[model samples]
Target: MNEKERAPIEDTHFGAVTVRQDGQDRIAVDGEAIPRVTLERDPAAETDPHIAIGTRDPAHLTMRVDGVEVGLLPAKGRFSRHSYRVDVEYDGAAYRFVPDSIPSSRLTRDGRHLGDFSSDGDETVLAEWREDGEIRPADAAIGYTLASAFGTGAQPMWMMIVDGVSNAIP
Candidate 1:
């Protein structure tokens, strides 16, 4: 496994919502698969012609774009893959990797809106964390990965290396 590699997208879950990669995003709305489009997917599909959207998760759904990924409907319980293309410059040297999609905002422990992670896209690299914003520092720590590009062995993806320090929830 490369140092930059992340966990397979299927194993990870968003917020309290859970969904599987490669499978359609069908959530049990009264025990029925309610079909819906993810917001992140909607924008990417409109902006980039290469985006391919999956089913909506009753919790949250993830969108795949030109190998990039982003979480849609995170509040519904999902993680974004790479909604935005970000360039990260780390340690006086620039290392640009795919940005893993995470919940941008969520209710805090005290019930307040707040950022999910802290990132400069130039300093700290991305990593995965629980919905509560706790870092496990485990090797198998859940993260994200990109689907292999056509004819390219490179599996482009990003993982949470340093959890973002978000703004205080009010």
Candidate 2:
């Protein structure tokens, strides 16, 4: 039997979650191994996406983490993009993860628009964050908000459209 090879997708980490495509596909949150994590369309499948140039309508990935699944990140099509939505049960209470409309200017915890993205340094990591439900506009450091909310954040450059294909993470 022969084996196929692909470039190693660098693992991106936020809060406790780490997305990696190394050996034996893996996703770990806060060091807890997420058994049987798979990315696919609504029906689910065992496949790796080869995003060709000019590919539109980027597929949606429903990440099954710890049996409490959520859409990992919204897809940006040729004409639009969608905000991140996540809902998880914490301490028997339902907590929802929501973000402001793009340009992803702000984010919220449980529907409360804590604050907008900070205009700090070039650290294009987390774009939504708050303390005690208070965030100051212009304090734009998007970090640990999404991951802390549903268990994350991404780089701003990650949102850039590369070669006609959006690199907003898979």
Candidate 3:
């Protein structure tokens, strides 16, 4: 498959949280750098080598942003479809992750939202994004929310190369 591409916007980022994929998901935005929750397929730190994220075993991963623990999606999602949800408690508000459900997915809060991501086929470029009801440029929510299922034309939407790392319901 060809890599996803988008027309670069000159300085689209303005006091916004942007995420971009820079060779191995550097997780950066607007020339600034931010840490992200990491997902290791076969983490050496894991005690059991047999435990792996696949069809049966759930993915045991930690989601961190800017070197801070933001959430945990440890083997609770459907591994069969590479779908997982990382529950998070940030700033006294609860947040949930939608691991690529078809063309897009989202990171939501109580009544509002955190991030909304959308894409057509290319998992690399998130076409639309919204955070907290604010319309953020596609890459504004950058840095990256790497998932087990990025997208690959798989049957299940989660299995597709990528659901969406940004936010958008419309």
Q: In what order do the candidates fall by lDDT, top score first?
A: 3, 2, 1
Please state the error at residue 41 of candidate 1 in Å: 3.2
What residue pairs clash in candidate 2, if any at all? 117-140, 118-139, 118-140, 118-141, 126-142, 126-143, 127-142, 128-142, 146-152, 147-152
29-135, model 2: which lDDT tens digit per residue? 22222233332243233433432111112253344433555434433322322333444333233334433343343554455665444212111223434556644
TM-score of each: 0.18, 0.32, 0.45
Candidate 1 per-residue lDDT over residues 1-170, each given as its tens digit? 11342332222322222112221221110001212112222222222122212322213333332223333231111233332322222123221223223422111222222123322211122333354443221111111211110000111233322222233333
**Global CA lDDT of candidate 3, please?**
0.38
lDDT of residue 86 for candidate 3:
44
The whole-model lDDT of each prediction reads 0.23, 0.32, 0.38
TM-score of 2: 0.32
Q: Judged by TM-score relative to the true structure, which candidate is superior, 2 or 3?
A: 3
Which portions of model 2 show Cα errors greater than 4 Å?
A: 1-19, 22-28, 31-60, 71-76, 80-106, 114-128, 132-170
Whole-model alpha-carbon lDDT for candidate 1? 0.23
Query: Of 1 and 2, which scores higher on lDDT?
Result: 2
